[model samples]
Target: MAPTRAVAATQMIEVDRLDRLLGAIYDGPTESPPWNTALQQMREALSAAHVTLMLRPPSSESHGVMINTGQVTSQGVESYETHFFALDPFVRLPEGEVVTAEELIGSQQWLKSAMYQEYLKPLDIRHLLGADIYTKEGIECRLRITRSDDAEAFSAEDKALVKLLLPHLKRSIRLHAKLDYLECDRQLFAGAVNRMLVGMVTFAQDGSILELNQEAQRILAEKDGIVRSGTGIALSSNHENRDLQRMIRQALTGGPVEEPVEGPSVVEAMSVTRPSGRAKLGIVVRTIPLGEFTGAKQRPAAAVFLRDPESSGTQPSQEVVRRLFGLTRMEAALALLLAEGLTLDEAAEKLNVRRNTARTHLRSIFCKTGVTRQTMLVRMLLNSVISLG
Candidate 1:
């Protein structure tokens, strides 16, 4: 009876350890450096001299991503990736199964291998436990844990712990990878929008600003026509403010009540007056399509696009335009000026060239672009993909 009670107590302790391990693994995706804390926790739990998560395995084409928590130096990691990665024998183990160096290659062979004699032996690491995780999302990563040469070999319990963690680790890695991809896409589109100098403002159902890009921040900071008003935005004129508010309400509530809704959204546009008397700000309001189960409280419900007529200096890169249209440097510059609403004479003066030289370049541009008129050439250049560069 006494022996059975002791065994039950040991099981309870193991359960508690497993719980802590599980917590770290699941929360790994939200960490700042994603999985750094979880890797550190794993190293402590396994009593490892070093633990490495190979998010990508090194190849001839790429160095790969690696996260380490232990006694290894950055130089040592670089050396392994550059030279010793190819010689490593304990890799490509049975997927989803925890394995040791001795189990994969005999202890004698492992010690005699070049990877050990040159790399592992220098680090004083002798014992190795590893697992390869292959997720359904086509992600493949490796977990490597090592102990010093003098330390005892990994126990059966250690192998079991890692085996239990493999599945959760795979899921967390998949989640982190998906989030990373989405963030990259968001940055790409946001950067393009900023390059176009378009001010974008998104709103919640309660009319609070949910997200505003860099250009939007600049426009609101100026406070010429549209300004940040408490949680929402306001126009300089009271009449325009009322109209803006009405448009916002319609966008939030799925468009005007009198119209038959054709789709999930509605579009409305108006020009807002400025107190500074520069130019009117063009405002476009549109509803964002809601998901079947999405709640609107703090989520993005509507978007406002603000275009300032006075902010006309922004245009596509000169080099990109030159390459895209196969134009000479002067031709590209002249086309850009024309796209900015400049007359041919004004463009030539800006370029410090004679009117005849500007006319010749314009003719060349028209010939290359297959446009017969100046207006068509200007429209074509404005609509080209050079702005995305």
Candidate 2:
């Protein structure tokens, strides 16, 4: 039958509240809206004393993220987690459907069950309405509204209201999941770059510093030859500074080159002398192409890599070398020493092994890494991304 005018007016008020709830869900910078506020709002709208949102169904084996109104005490929540979760009938219901305890099992049958006698009875919970907002890939997110024994059973209008809001809740869950995954990827990328041994600095089109890894900060802090001058980096030698600035300008303005240059157009390598007259610092400037126009305010135009010859930079971890090339501990150590610019005799002396033994280890490393010569092996190791860490 059609609803009376008063009933329709009341339903419209509920609809407005649902609209506000959705706005709260998607409006904030957080992965999801503050559930305490939203769930309280839901409780009032549904005329229930308590509401809860669970990212996954509770089980004895796993605990999931849960937010609830104050109606459920900490002890109650713990008890449910420990024992009553396995007794929940709502968890066994079909996914993506909004249902109530009465609809799932008759009221009399539920009252007789141990879940009610031992669990719900103590908490005074007599009615529950539930819906699964997300169910896929072994994950389940659900919402539940509960009422005490003195309250009436949930009406059809209440079920309809929750059902209407299900799609919006599902979309919000998907968005939060995607944001979480992207955040994890960002953390991993930042961690790998920060741990690199080579000093890496990225520059904008205007020669402004964009970003620098930890090693770059260390190198600049030394202030031996290269240091930060205003927003851009500067070299002690005027000639090398001019050359670096010119190369940066060319890289930013020239765009990407289709053909390879004879020797140094693509990459410019130079040496900067230290004030203390120690080993010179090697610097390589390479262009970073803007792949496609994205209308970003700041884009990287060039990358500067600084290598301190005396600082023992960019040494691959022996464990990583062993795992990658299937070399034993001794062979991996010998290979790493060679990559560090040591000759066979020097490496043997450092390792306290005979020259013949070093040679044998060197041959084993070559066989594992599929290189025929020491120069090729060193080049491969230096070029590998493992060297960065």
Candidate 3:
């Protein structure tokens, strides 16, 4: 037998090999990836009979993810997890225990599983070796490595190799967990951008559309709103509000840009052309270099800021009110402020109106709704779920 010192050195060497294989973490994983490269690299490095990447949030069911698998059938990776793995016995093991393939084969749990015998037997998979790890978010993760029946169950050497390799697996898994989370957040943010009440159209500095939120698109479609494409936005259809166009132009020049119309301002209007147009078009704009939010700088072309009439420094728009009240757009918007516990003055601040003006709108609201008081209106509107806001 080798001396204890020699054994320790050999183990150290093996661990180092695994560490080198794992190597450095590159800059954050890109949201989009070419799937084939990830799969091939991991498969070659692990030398495993089978490997799976998994992520499970706390209080939710777990999933197995393989990059190549995620690409071919975006839905396949998650299917077995939802349907099959809930009953997987091996998953219950503590973190870091390497259950050898034979051990898994010999388990009472394995023999007892009708799914395993009838299903896995035909596939020639007779043994499984697995490693479980945890993330900062407290999800339990495990990779199930398998071997065919013709091959002897993974030997002690296999367990040692796996043990040597586990840390790399853990680091990679953690990175994947973070990448998945960031992706979820990115999708959620994009959803928010697409749903905002204002008619927003953002682009790269080069002037390509990154996103035009739903409300913006509707306004653009309706001709109720004006938006410029690759060239520029229209000032106005009537006298042509040159000042507003100038603001957009200034923002395009890569500086801060804003045009404010005084509902009742202390200062008089100042413009190159003193044109009197009722309901002036006011635009707040900014320039976005390529890849402002996205990693690659070439993704976006500029950000065109728009605040249309329904969003005219007012309380939440009809769309927001609709979502909050679960009511039709017009009715929800009509009742929104009162239903949300905002008194006339608070509503005025949100709507950028005087208290008296807000009171006038409230009277109109009462006439339309048949409700005399705010408290009564709120109670009636929020009976089932008060927290929708």
Candidate 4:
């Protein structure tokens, strides 16, 4: 076969493999994919000192396949999994790019972490080689290989294996993201419909109801009275009205028509104290495009904003957390500083404590609140209260 034909055949074979991988991934619908065995097998497949996978872009914080034949983990694999993945410089790595561990540290990003001291030095993780399986939209999926103390950097064969497997990895990622997105969309739609105050009814120009919120149903029911059947608020009476229904007909006929809705009434309100005692009602219609909604119908959307002025009082002082957590006054002050996004060492200096001592107190604070990290503690504290002062 010609070189061009050979390349085409290779591309076709890879595409078929990718499709099969995606089909398998999508077929297993669990949120936490059962990749434990798969990862272990892949590490064995790729010849390296140690191999690992880092899922990227949205960052589920996984440090995948590990080969420890060289005694890489001293304490336990779980310890590394629990603590180190959060601080791993390997996860944020861009797609199609390779990294060396030394280069990672020399870049100055790793010096801020306790991880550098905790893992890298003790385990003797030397050279690192990794690649990102890039998506068209630039989301990176990290695949990594770690070299041990004795081993040189990854060899050419290792890189070739990664290149060979890139297509399969990319397909799994796309299917996983699609499932994730659809799930999120379902949740968001349910939440929005449940919370909306105004009675919403979306209709095709032909008068078919596409969607409605609960509140909208209630308001419509009030006008139409009790419904023994689903037909109570059926098609608009003006559907047959040539002039008025023309708008709905025109809308459903092609895509959309900008015309007013002629309902009996719609609730509108003005200040009760005004001399005129203004009462408003309308059958206002708005034009929409067919491309707006995901389905066949035109999308009619509205944002409902509600404010409860009564219970919007400020939170209790931060002193409460200080008292509860047994924090020193300075530590409590530092907690407030961290809640505002200050660093631990910055908080330490501001509170006049040594960094190590402040770190101890911070850990204690995290333990007391059931928070495992500074970021979590800061977020929780911010939600409840303000500065102690």
**Best model number under lDDT:** 1
Off by over 4 Å in 2: 1-19, 32-37, 47-50, 58-61, 69-83, 121-124, 135-139, 148-153, 195-317, 343-346, 349-352, 385-389
Off by over 4 Å in 4: 1-15, 21-82, 86-95, 98-129, 133-196, 203-210, 217-250, 254-287, 292-389
Preferred candidate (TM-score higher): 1 or 4? 1
Better of 1 and 3 by TM-score: 1
lDDT of 3 by residue, 76-154 (tens): 3344545545445556556777885337556776866864665556556677777778767776666556666776666
In model 1, the worst 10-residue window by lDDT is 1-10
What CA root-mean-square deviation does each model show from the true structure? 3.7, 5.9, 10.1, 17.6
lDDT of each: 0.86, 0.78, 0.53, 0.52
Q: How many residue pairs clash (N, CA or C atoms closer than 3 angstroms) in each of the candidate models, in the order given?
A: 0, 0, 12, 3
By lDDT, rank the candidates, best first.
1, 2, 3, 4
Once fitted onto the true fold, the runs of candidate 3 whose alpha carbons sit more than 4 angstroms away are 1-37, 44-49, 57-87, 104-115, 152-169, 176-196, 205-209, 219-228, 231-281, 287-302, 310-389
lDDT of candidate 1 over 184-205, digit per residue (tens): 9999999988877789999998
lDDT of 3 at 260: 46
At residue 67, give the lDDT of candidate 4.
Answer: 28
